[model samples]
Target: MSGHSKWHNIQAKKGKIDAKRGKIFTKLGKEIAVAVKTGGANPDGNSKLRDCIAKAKAANMPMDTITKAIKKGSGDMEGVTYEEIMYEGYGPAGVAMLVNVLTDNRNRSASDVRCLFDRNGGNLGANGCVSWMFQRKGQIVIQRQDGMDEDELMMKVLELGAEDFAAEEEVFVITTSQEDFSSVREALEKENFEFESAELTMIPDNTVSLSMEDAERVQKLVDKIEDNDDVQNVWHNAEFPEDFEE
Candidate 1:
């Protein structure tokens, strides 16, 4: 699996969670709303919307709530306008981090993010600071133990334009360049290959190994940044110890 999947699995095993449920919903809701706004509400016609809906379903969000979010985005209902933002920085041990956000109040979000970094042993940097260390890609995590042969699966995805494939923690992860993401996903779907998760995310080029103390500090910054009302995603280069939870 890709590094993203490893972190996700780690989070799952930890069984603990995000800042506040309400705030978490806000971040997710904005994603759905934005997707609908950008590409009409029809999932069949909007791949991004489809992905957002899938995540909403995975989170156990109600259908009515999802519909309401779409309506808000389509201007059928009034709501705060959300602006997408990205902040890059270095955490403890010089771990590179990127935080994606959607917020109506840019000033408030910026200050809160800056303070979070400062308080957590990190320092926010200029726009291009840590961004060059990452690449945007589409990733899919498949449960490898469900009768799927690794070599066969690798060949199949490779034919669909996947750049690389690997196995980790009993899961097979497929990666594709951003341009080929939709095509690759569709190919897999046509083959009836089931994926545990599919997402377009930032993947670090290389990881930074850290002492436990520094790792915890970086994680603390990550949690704080992600907790902000505007933040949508947090990515970092810190490699968690195999046994680290959450």
Candidate 2:
């Protein structure tokens, strides 16, 4: 579950996610289920499951729902089996895109996604076609409240050895290497910090800049793909215009 988050304030992003909470929960629940089936239900001993739980919580998924998903994954409860798949593609402006999906029927998903691309000025490519252009990184976002001091927060982030930091107008974004993600998140928790969202995300090595019209077209294509029940995320390298309004 990822997005071009650096382009928008985390708070506003949260609002958009909230609007689609049901679909997000379904996707996250599938992730939790698959993580458990693969590694076991114990988050402590299963880092993948642990990370999935953290992401589920960040999306404001209900605690009871989270517990049920764990149980379903562990086979204590009945649930449909789902498999994870990622589709690579290019959007309207040659913007590299990755669509993450979890489904019980691979053929149905592949056909549906290909049709979406065909109709939306995109081309679904073979696996690994665009994955190389992205890097997986850990990201933690904290909203800037009235009492938060940017310098003090940045100092803490630096001391924690995050790879990068950005203090946006309404939030603080801390990024770490993949291996350091869990430790950094734990450290922040010890200091009683709350995150708007914390998880591993794909960041593009470089972004594609297009005219405003093309950028909007790409965004529209992304939205259309995301509206599908089986699509978990749509990650793209479109560099949104600074003047763009949410």
Report lDDT (CA) for all predictions: 0.77, 0.82
Clashing residue pairs, backbone N/CA/C < 3 A, model 1: 1-168
Each model's TM-score?
0.87, 0.90
For residue 28, what is the lDDT in candidate 1?
A: 73
Which tens-of-lDDT digit does each residue in 1-246 have in candidate 2? 123356363453576688888878987888888899989989889988888887887788899999999998898535567778999988898999999898889999999999999999999999999999998888888878899988888888778878887877777888888888888887987888888898888888888877878877887788789889998877887777766554
Residue-by-residue lDDT tens digits, candidate 1, 1-246: 234446343344223233355565666788998888789888899988887875665454678988888888788635667788999999999999998988889999899999998988889999999999899998776666666788888888898899888777567778888888877877777777666666677888888877777767877777778767678888887887766555
Question: Which residue segments of model 1 deviate by more than 4 Å?
Answer: 1-23, 58-64, 77-79, 190-192
Give the worst 10-residue stretch by lDDT in candidate 2. Answer: 1-10
Model 1 TM-score is: 0.87
Clashing pairs in 2: none
- What RMSD value applies to candidate 2? 3.0
| Candidate 2: count of backbone clashes, pairs at least 3 residues apart or interchain | 0
